[model samples]
Target: MKIIAMSDSHGDRETVKTVSNLSGNAFFHCGDSELSFDDPLLEKFHTVRGNCDSDHRFPSNVLVEIGDKKVLAVHGHEHDVKRSMMMLYYTAKEQGANIVLFGHSHLYGAEVEDGILFLNPGSTRLPRGGNEATFAVIEWDKTLRISFQNLNGEVIDSLEIKNFTKEH
Candidate 1:
């Protein structure tokens, strides 16, 4: 599966549309989308609510089963994202997911832990540190492969997930 991940849009729906349309794949907005779930363009999108989203209609976290992969999606604000990954790691595991997609730090990251893949697409509208606006893609074929791309569509990072099995 090819999936595009992004977060912290803060309300810039155009960038989301641009990337979402080009990929022709499912889009996952980690959080801080700052838009109503009723968004017209997001009719087919999957997302979770962020700290900024106070609407009870949106959830702060979600678990989605895509093919053979179980994915945990969250915004990370409630998880104290910058301080540690311990909570996030365990949360995903508890969900029995093979992949975790989260944002809120507005940074890009990809790593494998105990057979699980963790990914953050960074912020497309308000990036932190020296990072540029970015998003992520996951391509899987019995294995999860991740690649991060900037707004210009240049790949900045890549990783492959391993140790994934029913035992995990």
Candidate 2:
């Protein structure tokens, strides 16, 4: 399955539209979009609510079933991700999610712990930690391939997870 992952756009609708133009079986918006829940531009996304979001229509978290992967998507603020991911990790495990998508620190990162893949696509509007604004794409099957890209569709980083399994 192919998936597009992005977060923290903070109301930059055009950038989200541009990035969503890419091909994918699923699209995920990890929140802080500052867009309405039913915004036309975000129509294709499985979105969660961010701390900055005022839309009551947006859920705090969302569960998406992509291929054989159970993905849990969150904004990270309510879970205090900047200080620790322990709570978030527990939530994912409890949800039976094999993949967790989140954004808040505006930092791009990816890591696997005890068979679960956690990804932060960074902030497309205001990147932090000296990184450029970016989003992420994933291609998963027997292996997982991740690509972090800028608004111009330029790849900034790439990673391949050959050991990520469906059964977390």
Cα lDDT for residue 45, candidate 2 = 94
For all predicted structures, in order, the TM-scores are 0.91, 0.97
lDDT of 2 at 66: 92
> In model 1, which runs have C-alpha deviations exceeding 4 angstroms?
162-168
CA RMSD of each candidate after superposition:
1.8, 0.9
- Give a tens-digit lDDT track for model 2, residues 1-168: 899999999999888899789899999999999999889999899999998999979999999899899999999998899999899999998999998999999999998887888999999999998999999998887889999999999999999988566675
Q: For candidate 1, lDDT tens digit of each residue in 1-168?
A: 677888888889887787777663567888888888888766666889998876557788888877677888899988888899999988987889887899999989988878788889999999988988889988887566788888788888887765455554
Model 2 clash pairs? Answer: none
